[model samples]
Target chain A: MHDFFFYLFSALTVLTALLVVLCPNAVNSAVFMIVSFVGTAALFLLLDAFFLAILQVLVYAGAVMVLFLFIIMLLDVERSSRVRPDVVTVVAASVAVLLLAFGMGYLFLTGHDATAATMAAVPQVPGGANPMEYATASRAFGYGLFTKYMLPFQVAGFLLLVAMVGVIVLSKRLTGSNEAGKPSAQEIRESEVSQS
Target chain B: MNHSELLTQLSEQYVSTNQWCALWPEIALALLAVLVLLIDLFAGRLRARAVPFAAIAGQVVIFAVLLGKLGTCDPADSGLLFSGMILPTTLSEVMRLFFLLASILVCWLGMLYLRKQDLPRMEFYCLTLIVTAALMLLGQSSNFVMLFVALETVTIGFYILVSYGRNSIFSLEGGLKYLVLGGTSTAILLFGIVLLYGAAGDPSLPVHSGDSLNFLALEQFLAANPNNVLAKVGMVLVLCGVCFKIGAVPFQIWIPDVYQGAPTPVTAFLAVSSKAAGFIVLINLVTGPFGPMASLTVPLLSAITVVTILFGNLTALGQRNVKRVMGLSGIAHAGYLLLGIVALIQGVELAAWAVIFYLFTYLFGSFTVFGVMSHLAGPDDENQEVDHYVNLARRQPFLAGVLAIGLGSLAGIPPLAGFIGKVFLFVVAFQANLYLLLGVAILGVVISIYYYFGWMREAFFQEQTWPEGKEEQLAPIKVCLPHKVAMAALAIITVLLGIYQGGFGGGF
Candidate 1:
């Protein structure tokens, strides 16, 4: 059953990811990207990484997708015109795809037995505790994050703060008369009228 | 073990690993950034003047303190802190100082840039401070997680900075292009990190590691399995991501447009500090976890160096825009620096020092040129043409002299700091037996002189032919007192470093 569900979600992920790239409309591409993220979350669930799976959904699918959709709407991006691939581009892409397919095939065929043997050799957990139990618990992630990963956590906060400041700097309109040396909106309008 | 005992053990681990004292400079930088933001909030009318002064003053103080504490802060004595997340060696200490110096100059340039354009000034300083702090951390990071987080902070800071002149369509266009490209590179870097983690964490491997993201453990794993295909692919992908940052060929498509469009100070920041950060990270990887994979890296980097040198110089030859010329020539410099990396990989230990020296010379020369560019730039910052510099020597000889020295140094002319830097790198490359790469680099230098001197010609030798009513546009550029002092200091350093190598010149 685990194998069955893994294959199902893996297929869902690859298919939707392809659609995300193939979709001409920017909005549709973003929607397909969300579906791809959900499929990845489901695959993580199959691995019994319950905490990661939930975070994946909450962060990438929920929050990040909302931002993508918002930007798409704000920009009012039209359906992108799909340019026809020239002969050279088509040939080059075909060669790349063929090489990739060949490489994957070669690796799987020769390495299958080695992979099985390595899996058998994996060391068991101490005291025979279920590995999934430790990884799946939300508290385990919290402990790791607060303890070992404290520096990155703090830096990520600063990253978000910078993003916020940057958004305002890029988009904010200075309109007040109090702004030193800067032309107010009224002054700017008058200057424009004079120039015209 | 009892539940209470386990809890106590965990707390003990946390207490032992969290060495906050080692991170004082980074912490102080973050605080300074916040203080700048707060000052902007409350300073009201004086905010513009107050914020830059505070930011630059704070950075100068931190730089002094870090320099004083340099000898005592070596990781050789203290070992890795934060459970091997940060490894502060003598090199990282120097990088911290380098980044602070760059940030201070960038803020000063930002003040000059903001005077003409009506833009929000405070955020620029705040972001520069935060990004500098992150770059210092990036140089010291011993874990992939730390590296990624710090790198993202720097990249995001640059994205906002690149487009800070939001009123200009060119700035916005450059920002979007950088956004798309930078995001793609980050994804590639993340994917590579994930692959390495997966490969190293495989319990079936001969020497598997539980903490696969740590550089030391990953090094051990890689050393044990020198022929691991997965790890090799991961290493290449990681290098590709870094190459994008340093603007190597095939990944340098964004350099010309972005440099031409970004505010001059931001472009200077990207060219000097950002590129320096990328090289430091590359050096760390090649000499650390990727050390064992020298068989794969040396040949790969050699090929890239060849193409990057020839391509950068050839493309730069025909460029008329000064910014585009700087961007392309900077690529050729990256190629020269890559020679140092290749030498380091081939067992020349002193090659790393050579790379750092070259970066220092680059910073001095590039900033001097950028300082002049900022002074000469009109209201439309993006459209600085080479023709604008005609007869600059007659009009403003001080600025013209500084521009000549800066461009001459960048061209690796004799009796300039850039010449000494190239000599050291070539010596190291020769020691490593990279004869072909050395030849290509020399050829690249010869080719670069044409363009660098072309700009010089426009400034010093070209005759001015003003069109009707164009004399106002070509009026003598006024250089303020502070700017003159700064540019003079930079130019003097370029000449002084060329003549005297100080401590950095001893070993080479």
Candidate 2:
């Protein structure tokens, strides 16, 4: 059952990811990426990474994807008539296959029996970090995050605040523009004045 | 007992609740960040210059606390926290200390940078703390989940800094490019992590309760299956994502634009702190979570190093934009650091020593060059072109000399810190039998000379005219408090590191 779910979601993820990369229109690609993200979130769940799965939904799907869509809609990006960056596409495709081959080779040589034995030892929770026996992801991760790795957790929060400020500051004001489609800041101001 | 019953018992018995000692640095940084923000919010009531002074004071306190924590963490430790998701040991301690120090310098320069720019100074200081805290976490992360979160935290801060000069379209463009590329890379990183999770997930539970994002499990996982194709694929994708952070080739697309478009002080921070954090995280992942999987990691980093070296130097050759040139050169330097990572695969080697020393030495050198650039670039930093430096030698020989020394070190000229750093890495690579990569690295350095000197030619020898009435464009040869202090500190240290390559226990 686990294998079935893994394979199912893995295939869906790859397919959607492909659509995201191959799709011509920005909106379509963005939508495809959202699907891909959802598939990954589900796959994380199937893998018993409940915390990670929730984070995927909360962070990637909820916050980040919405932002991606927002930018896409704001820009109203259409498919360029240019031929889809053919060289980059081909190179990326080839590299993907090569990496896939390498992963397969690494997997084939792994120690299965040793891993199985380790798995058997997990449920006993001899040292208390064996998440295998735990029913909820939050309990184990929370304990770890708050106690042992609390510093990193807090630091991660700090990083988020900085990123938020940085984005707002960087994207808000533009002094000069040359050789491009002009932003509508002037028009908006004019509309505001007319309204006034 | 039920599974929950068993877990509850073990949690009390083995997972001691006394791990706060391991969390000192992070706590300090977090408190510092909040304190700065609070101070900034109420500076009018408190006092004048509260923002920079208070921020500096807070940072100093955090720095001391972080150092004290580092002094306490045992190197031989294999301790685990939060269900083995975070590990802070010898490696993390070393990285944490370096990051803290770098952030201090960045904050200092950032404060000096904002005085005349008229950008909001308080928010800038506040963001500095926030990013510093993020970088500290990035250094200690032992799991994939934390890795993603920490990486995003820093990148987001950078995006804001890049575009902080909202009035300029160039800054916006840089921010936009970073956002688009960063978002794409993050997606790729997530995909990679999920793939690996799928390949090795536990089967006993309905949802795999033990995805094992922690390094210990990952190490066990890789050594157990050196040939796991799916896992290997995941690792490569992860590396690609990290590679983007470090400005390595292929992922080098955004660095030039972002660096050029960013404010000078911000560019200095980006080049030093952001790039250093990326390497620290890379070292952690390669040596920790991905440690078992050398068959893939070694070759990947080696190849990346080679290509990164060649590409960065070659592209920088033609760049007229000073910032863009530095951006490309930054890529090349990342390649040099990757060499240290590749060497660690054989055994726990001291190759990382060279990388650390180089990062430390380059911080001063790069900061000096960018500091001068910022001063020249003016309030909005409009002039980024190489020709802007024509006759700098004639006008500001002292500043020109300092730039020369910085560029010289970057080009790996002998009797300079960069040369010693290169030699240390080269020896390590040689010992590891990566002769081909060493040869490529040497070639890359040789190529770098042309580009580094190309700028020098404009700055020192050229006779190009400035736009009408821009005589004060060049800084004075006489050193000021800030510039002199920064230059003296970096120069003295760099010369010391280069001349006495043996002792001082620095490259740990």
Residue-wise lDDT of candidate 2 within B1-508, one digit each (tens)? 3555654565564347346555667667767777777876676656337767777777777778666765564644645565555666666676677777777777777765665464556677777777776777777767777777777788788778787655456676787799899999988888888867765565432223355566666667767666556677788888888888898887888988888877777788889888888888787777776888887788777878888999988888888889888889899999888887888776647876667777877786787677667556655564578876788888777678778888888888898888888888888788888888888888989999998888888888776566776777454544477667776677666667678866534543
lDDT of 1 by residue, B248-304 (tens): 886898999999889999999999999999999999899899999998898889999
Query: Candidate 1 — number of clashing residue pairs?
Result: 0
- Cα deviation of B156 in candidate 1 (Å)? 0.7
lDDT of 1 by residue, A1-196 (tens): 8898899999999999999999999889999999999999998888778788899999999999999999999878888788999999999899989987886676556533325543634354455545557546776677778888899999999999899999899767665444664556565445434532
- Per-model TM-score, in order, reads 0.94, 0.81
Best by TM-score: 1
First chain TM-score for all predictions:
0.74, 0.64
TM-score, model 1 to reference: 0.94
Candidate of highest DockQ: 1
* Per-prediction DockQ: 0.41, 0.24
Candidate 2, CAPRI quality class derived from DockQ: acceptable
Model 2: TM-score for chain B: 0.90
